[model samples]
Target: MNTPRLAHRPVPPHRPYRSKEFPVPDTQTQPLDPVALHRDSVVFNALDCTPLAWADETYLGKLAASGVTAINHAVSVSQGYDAAAAALVGWQHRLAETDGRVFQAYGLDDVTRAKETGTVAWFAGFEDSKPVGEDLWRLAALHQLGLRFMGLTYQNRNYAADGSGESANGGLSRFGRSLVAECNRLGIALDLSHTGERSTLETIETSTKPVLVTHAGLTHFVDSPRNKSDLVVRELAARGGVFGLAAKSGFLTPDGLTRRPGAEVFADNIDYLVELAGIDHVIVGTDVGDERKYSREGMARVRRLYPEIPIVGADLDLERIHPEGLGTPADLPLITELLAGRGYSGEDIGKVLGGNLQRVLAEIWDSASGE
Candidate 1:
């Protein structure tokens, strides 16, 4: 399938950075206050893989403290239909138990309402499409239950498509094409972050609406196969899709495990993505997990689940997966500061912060209505 190459706005030139270091823009002028800007802006994290007890006061408190207004929370991570459905229902109940403190968002209006109410909005997302199984109706059922976005695969292949971790890039299965059509018809945005190369490209061409790479690193900076190549990234942006530059340290730096790169590296990653995908196509997607996720028990659980995936190997420190100063949602204001320090205009900074994802999501969500 031939996809028309959509033109992108001229990219801003980025200065070369020494490994693990980002140079501050040369200027004597006072830098913009990112704290204030973050507070007022409609900050959206396209994806955050942190598993949390939805009604937990501590978790809710952390979100309340963060500059983020909305988050695409991963509800299904490599789970099959039954498990995924149960998880979705559990989150729904939790949101109901939150006593209006946290709202489960279904569309752009919910985001606006969340901003106006000064509360956090959670968009239910799936990190894998295993839950769909071989049935499109199951997908529609999940969507009606608030499953807004879904990935074609996790780090491994399922019935629909191959994941990035697969040795064989078989692309999307026949079932996958049907899944894409179902997602388009149901107004559910598709995600290709952990999908295999061929599968990712195929899905982009197949989908009627813009897709999302919600959380992943760029292979240009870190030569990890888990990251997306420039070819895939550019194609995604050219088709009006959004690329979420992640905060994973291991994927962000050369010796990320011991080096423990700070927010500077993350800022640089954002800059690299903006240069490649254009500022309008980039957004923040942090994979920073919570305390339980980094616990030794958590590592054991992950290893048991996917022993072959190198990301869960014993050598990696789950706590250091994300760069310093960006380990939690509360620290997101630092991103705005770094972008401003790098000479990004307030308009562009807002776009990167959340505006870009918002625009594409609205485009995808509203596509069904237009049809």
Candidate 2:
């Protein structure tokens, strides 16, 4: 046999396949005890599904096991004020039924207690301020319901402002400015994750208190409208604001259109921000949505499209792929391990993990107290 013609010979003009490449840390060794490293660490997940979104007791247990100390419970993404208010009441009732497995954090005391008891503190937030309604008084009502943070808009335009993805991203409208002022007065944390450029800039300038872009990527990294620019990042940090890096694959990588990279890519994005803004301004906000809803079919399609990319499975295991070594909330120790490998001191890693968010929360709560 003529060497069997090396079955499936390539045709003319065929090029050799090149293996995908990712940066590897120079240090070869990992920490001896990742669990001990994460023992005192806390995860501040800025946005996640609540009961309204189908997150149940099992889910909450998973979250607790994952090491999530607090989550900014998204109460209203598009609900009107009446509906949002009702939903808040419902959540409170559910918490009562769960025997305070989840506590709503309205002030520093609540957060401290949650930390002490190892309970998941629910920091109320509206994904879209649409519920604040045309009337600004509705904001006061929502604030009363312990809605501590407010995202000015979702993925579409609303009365307060244009969303980042809007076709015409004119900054905050007149009403939006008014709403920001009210949010400032009421002691609510302003979030600009999906706000348009103009709106984000205007809100940053208008708010007397430091605002939060709870979860987002850098514009330079992925160039998505949803990603914040370097200028915005610098300004936010200058005002003592915190930028929580998101886990959404689309905004985190250059090839978001294909495969979502793991924590390594996420860490690269974090590295960029830390390099630009320093560790004090960087924090984790996976923006990891309802884990129960992620389907195998969807992941399979993603895998096929970006064969070189690694997709975080529905189980939320970050250690398998993320360079940061963050798999689940429980796997937070991996971050310490990776940071150690990168030569980051314990202090620096602590700040990035939770200290920064704690500072921001304290500032906002203090401002509210004064008012």
Specify the highest-lDDT model's number. 1
TM-score of each: 0.88, 0.80
Task: State candidate 1's TM-score.
Answer: 0.88
In terms of lDDT, the poorest run of 10 residues in model 1 is: 15-24
Query: Which pairs, if any, clash in model 1?
Result: none
Clash count, one per candidate: 0, 13
Model 2 reaches what TM-score against the true structure? Answer: 0.80
List the candidate 2 regions with Cα displacement exceeding 4 Å: 1-33, 50-53, 295-334, 369-371
What is the C-alpha RMSD, rounded to one decimal, of candidate 1?
6.4
- At residue 26, candidate 2 shows an lDDT of 23
User: Relative to the true structure, how large is the alpha-carbon lDDT of every model?
Assistant: 0.78, 0.69
Task: State in Å the error of residue 126, model 1.
Answer: 0.6
